[model samples]
Target: MSTSLVVGGSGRTGRRVVERLLAAGRPVAVLSRRPRPAAGVRTIVGDLDDPATWPAALADVDGVVVCVGPPHDAAGAETVVHRGVAALAAAAAERDLRVVLVSQIYVTRPQAHPAMAHVTEARARGEQALRASGADPAVVRPGWLTDEPATGVRLEQGDTGWPTALAALTPDAVAGSL
Candidate 1:
């Protein structure tokens, strides 16, 4: 069976990725700082600051999905997503594994919202690093997420929502897209 490593597995998108991967009969491993239990998914405790734990979590994995978001501070955001994503890409390159990275839509249009500058910059940097790492990356740029449940969701390419679009997406909707 194929194996997948999901970073930020407990977060909005990460958790759903874990669930979907498991449902597809793939071996799932979740990498997070505060690891939690999820049926059918193996949880691995770790963080981006020390990627040493990544090798173990990524062992024999066919693909890696980075769904981790930036931190509150600008520098921290860069470190966690940009630098951390670069590290994951490097690791996947060494093992010849595919990668799927989650990025926000606003990052490309910084002028759309003044408050989103730093985050958008950080996400753009992360995407750049992944593209440079020789890993065939599937970049998912989602719109404003809605917690309004997943009864009906429409996933499309490109930026569909804005900073205040308020069109939140449930984790299941994103999982379905994947």
Candidate 2:
């Protein structure tokens, strides 16, 4: 059986990814700062900012699903998002593992909500870092997430105007895509 690692798997979206992977009969592992015990999932406790804690978690995994978010402090975006993602990407590249990065939409926009500009900038930088890692990673940019059920999902390449109706995307839908 193929094994997959879900970074930030304790978070909402990452949890859903783990669930989907488990349902599909794939052995799954999660990387998080704290342990989350799921019946069929393995948990690895580590800090994303520190690459030294990654080897055991990345070992034997065929692919990775990264759904991490930056720290609340805007100034820490570089360390938490950019460098963290780079570290994961570098490890995956060395092991010849496929990667799927779950990023937010509008990260490439010139402007963003004042409170979110730093995160957007950080995500953009993360995307660049992944591309440069020589891993051929796949990046998914989802719209604002909601607890509501999935409906009328659509996929587009590159940036586009945000949808006026049903702008929210469900975690389940995103997980299915992953």
Candidate 3:
């Protein structure tokens, strides 16, 4: 990759991905609402839900990684996750850039928790939009991610009760994932 745009790149998972991408000699640009102290990466202050921000964010980008966190409110979640991701998918398809979406495991069981159901549903919808957009994006739904060191990876299908605890997304792990 030449230049990769990491949405929500100041977050724990995104930070690690940015680091790994930078270390690999690929320039990285981060589109985030909050400003972070990152030296090499270009940090663009913007919201993923806003369409206007994407023009500048994707201007010099080759690949994209959507690590966006949904808002607590139902409407905000829908706008950010569903609408934001759909916009991202459309942009990626137009530019022929592959996307790597970082989603959570709870998205599978959106109804499992009534309180946070909206967030899960929104992310699930985003995943659906990406799939339907024909962007051929890679979606990684990790369970209980942590900032610690990584163990390994195991593929499973619609897993329900596995990984009750946190799994780490260290730089090495993030490099492997990217």
Best by TM-score: 2
lDDT of 3: 0.84
lDDT tens per residue, model 3, 34-152: 95968888889998888888788888898999897788999999999998999988888888888899987778777777899999999999999998887869988887688888656
List pairs with backbone clashes in candidate 2.
none
Per-residue lDDT tens digits of candidate 1, residues 1-178?
A: 7679898999987877887888888899888998788777788889865779877988878899989877867898889878888888888888888899988887678677777688788888998899999987889887655545665545666665653334555575556755
Off by over 4 Å in 3: 159-178
| Candidate 2 structure quality by residue, lDDT tens digits, 92-149 | 8998888899988887783846678888888889889999998869999887677677
The segments of candidate 1 whose C-alpha lies over 4 angstroms from its true place after superposition are 149-178
TM-score of 1: 0.83
Q: What local lDDT does model 1 show for residue 13? A: 76
Q: Give candidate 2's TM-score.
A: 0.88
